[model samples]
Target chain A: MKKNILEISSFSNEKLKYISGLKEKKNREKSGTFFIEGFREIQRAQISGKVKFEYILTCPDCYLGENEEDLVSSIDAKTILVPKQIFEKISYRDRPDGLIATAELPDFSLSSKTKLSDDPILVIEGVEKPGNLGTILRTAEGAGFHKVFVADPRLDLFNPNVIRSSTGTLFTLDVFQSDIKELYPILKNAGYKTFAVTPEAKSLHWDADLKGKVALVFGSEQYGLSEYARSQSDQYISLPMKGVADSLNLAMSAGILMYEVLRQKSQIDN
Target chain B: MKKNILEISSFSNEKLKYISGLKEKKNREKSGTFFIEGFREIQRAQISGKVKFEYILTCPDCYLGENEEDLVSSIDAKTILVPKQIFEKISYRDRPDGLIATAELPDFSLSSKTKLSDDPILVIEGVEKPGNLGTILRTAEGAGFHKVFVADPRLDLFNPNVIRSSTGTLFTLDVFQSDIKELYPILKNAGYKTFAVTPEAKSLHWDADLKGKVALVFGSEQYGLSEYARSQSDQYISLPMKGVADSLNLAMSAGILMYEVLRQKSQIDN
Candidate 1:
């Protein structure tokens, strides 16, 4: 809610060029910054205090709902007020709430989340879809898993779809990319058993001894767990696929497993 | 494989006009037939033999994988071969597999799925998104629930998104629409315990006794189970939302609860 306001109506503006360039993954990697488009999402990222914002873009005319200005006022960042047409051109959402914040990508390193949970260490490998990745983070957060490690990510962690699908839970959770090969040794050193979810596995998730510290590993929906992922596991677990479903979507698979982990922990606690 | 192939290339063709017009919800409603685009999905619908196919449109050059011709040859219906451009124009997929089948909407009434399972009855109510509906059908099938009763559906059963997201499992299950009011009485008469899922519900799904004949009821993601859905339910149950997640996605919610029902049954079976 700083007093210094910068208005950029021209599409060719330098700051506008940099903002639109962020839609590309290469630019995000180069800048080490990503944009969160909704006021609710931006507020979540701001509240987490993990990310440092450079600026916020607002189009008061294009806003869909309440208190968007309040969010703009709350965050200590340069504010850009553009016309509705200029704002819509930059917006990714169908019904945007007219606030977008650009923030420095915080560390998703597994090191940032050590000692966060005694529950299952949730690690996702070679995730190809941003929606799945985002949904996984949301599911992990919802199930009370503190940190989710992304190993060999095919998509960027801050893909707008990931932010949207996670409903801004991305900021609340410790989600970072690490190599799957490197991840297992650390998990093992930390006295954790690793369970890779694969369709080939004979073990049902229900039968697995998740009462102890464990890591639930998953691969892309297109490819089940990698050969390395399967080989490194302490056990192989699977959900039942009875009729026509070849496999569950990655996020759905993660949800079922995370809740199973939660359920087992609740049994112990109660 | 039946070989009744009728080739049509012109976009202005009368039959092609009908196929493209079905893209509109109004056209689909007027004709009482919906189009499912994808080779795998058409094959499932053909194999299910529950709905009568009106015709199929295919473009061999546009197919991404094998067996397009085999599917066209198997179904005993009129086939029209078009160029890649015509197929792409009608396809909702980013990567089209070049098969679109038109079929009359099948009966979605609970009576249609009668005697399908002694397992927990699966009932989805007031679902707004086609993707969620499709995923719910896939989850029900995977968890070994034979029939999925979609009550008061907000979207058509055979929406392209539903067909695609379900991975063609829509054809393999008994999916039908009926009012929520009508569903429970029939379920009650059939000795099924109806558990409506809502966030306001005090009982957790894990703690709920689901061993007996039961029905898991779900509402739209935006609005939890409707008042009729909640009040009519024998008990209201909720999935845990530990972090910032307001609620689980409709499909993910269904997946967790269906698996929970499956887990309890597995215990008794052992």
Candidate 2:
């Protein structure tokens, strides 16, 4: 056992209760902390230095991989050892990796304290599913997007599903959440050409000059960009719909649009 | 009740047992029928005229939409009426639209009878998740690809999640599934330059000549294309991974690559 490790014997321990409490949005808000599970997610969070984890729970016995002990020793936070049963009780995953940590939620508001970037930004509006938001973040990273902003999100930004699906890019990327009113000014001041994605748009996505600084907005398939979002956006662009499916999945839309920006900027066009 | 409608009140009714039993893959294969839910999905399946629905279960009591009776009226299949409790019992969705149908699974094997499209083909290899397959189908439709072939799929072709996530594109799109050996010859004979998508590949996807007849194969992120798949492909191509994320989500990768093919072919490139 590590120097800081303390074994958790009972299921009803306060740490176990606290770790599970972050599952609820209200508890996370009140406590100002959310939970991070999985080995890769914690490592990314640690390297990013954007958020602080108060402590972590590790069940070496339940671990699937050989590196759990090494990762525990590397982090600056306190580590609490756990039995397999107790770890499984607090875990969100079907196959637990034997690591769970309570992390202080970063301030996602567009305040002066927040670091803004010149790299192409991806914005999602009213994302209804955590999986969609997580995927967009991962896609955004793959497409070289440095920053992402969510406007009027339906799911909590720190939802564990988001972290799980993102494969930890949620920590590596600059993720911010704010309402529509708070969103546009930052992009405008940053001199970003905001492209509002809609199926009804006149300009096809590839037709738009996505080069230079830009922010791409994706909305729900059922209800597109809010009236306010449409109004704030500089251009209305759409992916070409050739077959019966009128809209691509929300994450898929983000992937296509984000890459289009990269494709235009990379001097690799036709 | 309509002329062919039968009310199912008892939970132990054979009709109810039979409906719920299709959840298992063996049952779906044995009975050769899978379930679909949602109004928009059913409407699309009806219009596609490809697969045949054996029957539909409807709960007028639990209906959130006003158009259930009208949709039930249009289909030729027998309608089984159920109370709210029974509808919820057999439902895969959190909120059932009061419509669930057992549609005969179309033979997905690539045989001489299979319809081939000159349009760009999208093939997924060893897909581990139904959601990824479903999203790829939806994206393929939006990107104008008419046919989708799955090779060595881990999940069943007609998995309920695939149907749910595809939003009934499963019916509208010509879907075929076969082993890796059965796949290559069809593409080879069709004169397609198969682009095998792997992160390790030298040629970027956009840089590839996606013009005319092409088949793009996306593999699992953890496991790239099987040895036979790599050996069979005409070109190994990759999406530019610019940031910390080593790979995009399987569906997102499909979305990006599918759009790239469309982007190059449509004369929309820079």
Q: Can you give the TM-score per candidate against the true fold?
A: 0.93, 0.95
DockQ (0 to 1) for model 1: 0.71
Candidate 2 docking band: high
Worst 10 residues of 1 chain A by lDDT: A110-119
DockQ of 2: 0.86
Q: Write the per-residue lDDT of candidate 2 for residues A178-232, one digit (tens) a residue.
A: 8878878978987889999998898999888988878898886558789999888
Quality class of the docking in candidate 1, CAPRI style? medium
User: What is the per-residue lDDT of model 1 for residues B4-49, given as tens digits with 9 covering 90 to 100?
Assistant: 6788878899999898888678998899998888877888888888
lDDT (Cα, tens digit) per residue for candidate 2, span B1-270: 345678879989987898899977999988888878888788888888976988888888778878888888888888898889888989998888898888888777889887566789988999988888888887888888899989998888788888888888887888888888888898888777898999889888878889888999888655868999999888899889998666778888888888888888888334
Query: TM-score of the B chain in model 2?
Result: 0.94
Most lDDT-accurate candidate? 2
The top-ranked prediction according to TM-score is 2
Error of 1 at A17 (Å): 4.7
